[model samples]
Target: MDVRLFKQVRAACNASTEKVADGLVGTIVEIGGDPLTVRKAKDRLSAVLQKARNGVPQLVGGPKKGEEMAVVISVRDLAELVVAARQQETLGEALDAIGFKPYRGAHILVGQSRKRERLKRSGDAPSAATAN
Candidate 1:
């Protein structure tokens, strides 16, 4: 993707909520379908792809209600999303290294086992014997 489009995608990915990100990602052509609509979409696939390349994503809903939806975006956008996802994974790893643990979908600083041991040794925290 071009620099501008990449920036926009990055911002969208970083948005706190998916609903907020949807707005930042630009136009979304939602295809909620019947068989005829699906046929039409197939015939216009090239045009839809071109639109996606230009940063307008297509959200194709599943055949049945309450099923998952699929998004059609350019390969470049897909690559950027992969990179963003990896970055998030790396961030989670780093946070874990620094004594943060995942708690209820968020990270909480619960000091590492080694740190807890040191604190116990230094009389900063109660020992197991004392707790009982």
Candidate 2:
């Protein structure tokens, strides 16, 4: 996988959607859903990490270690993001709507292809993948 490309996409989305709150840096924490999913997973993970650092949330009836928190992201979250973006009449339009500037068809194609690759890797083949 192109880690740089992933970073670029992640950075772009983060810059566009993240916001500060409660005097803290908080990005929109998407759970097992799209961009709009509740930030509970992220928040829970953060809480656990924070508590561990503070030596809190003491484990009971077991080792004094921290309680394990499992926050699994579902393939549906990614699918919904792609579906939401692709709902646009055109790839260019969709990218633009997502705050991504697409200068050429090639760029849009690349983006779509990347999304397809992610879906494939996710093992939740989207219907669009079968259409073409």
Candidate 3:
């Protein structure tokens, strides 16, 4: 993927993680603190797995307030995440090779313009506007 599109995807993924953690994405099942509730969830593990297979992630939260949570997702969903992560890593390596530095914000590429200018002066980069 191009740099711009990759940046957008990265931003969206970050937002999605935040939303999921906030219990805004899917069904949240509170466990951990309450022994009975935890036992019930364990007993109903098959049903929860089925729900996840149907594309509804089960957010397993801790019993205490403001604790970290875990998500139960289908293997398909997990594979997608793994693929996206690999693609992001590959693109990041390519960007590093081409002098694109990660900046403060999600969309910003530090020194990008300067790099382009330097490449142009060195006649090592093609001009996209004039290529066609």
Candidate 4:
């Protein structure tokens, strides 16, 4: 809600942090009414924010059907969160397609043939030579 917080969200967006995209720090403001669902309220609120065309935090989720639940999140923060969510989904799909079942620490696959040549000269494996 503060200017500083918005800046932080922008920075996270640049870094592509997923936590922000998942509405981790956003607050949900509930609106009570008759014959109106939470999802509808949320949608209406989102529309209003978008029309305003300002840098204020915006609504993420819609009002729930037959209920009242609206979520308000910083636009910048939401962007970062969305980026994180999408990246995870993409990575998962790629791994599944390749039948990859990782069972240990992350495997950092770096292409360093030139470096490997240098390491061979120094009588060391690529990893150890890079350490030097």
Candidate of highest lDDT = 1
Name the TM-score of candidate 3: 0.41
What is candidate 4's lDDT per residue for 1-132, written digit by digit as tens?
Answer: 344443444345334455554432342121111222445645586554553244344343334554423444456646754554344335666586467987888887998565443325544546765778
Model 3 spans with C-alpha error above 4 angstroms: 1-9, 12-37, 86-99, 102-132
TM-scores for all predictions = 0.40, 0.20, 0.41, 0.25
Higher-ranked by TM-score: 1 or 4: 1
Model 2 residue 16 CA deviation (Å) reads: 8.9
For model 1, residues 15-125, the per-residue Cα lDDT tens digits are 567654454333332222222244555888897678678766666554576554566678877787667544533676558546796567767679656544332546577
3 against 4, candidate with superior TM-score: 3
Better of 1 and 2 by TM-score: 1
lDDT of 1: 0.56
- The order by descending TM-score is 3, 1, 4, 2
Give RMSD (Å) of candidate 1 vs. truth: 14.1
Stretches of candidate 4 off by over 4 Å are 13-16, 22-38, 41-47, 62-132
All models, RMSD in angstroms:
14.1, 21.0, 13.1, 13.2
Indicate the TM-score of model 2.
0.20
The number of clashing residue pairs in each candidate reads 0, 0, 0, 8
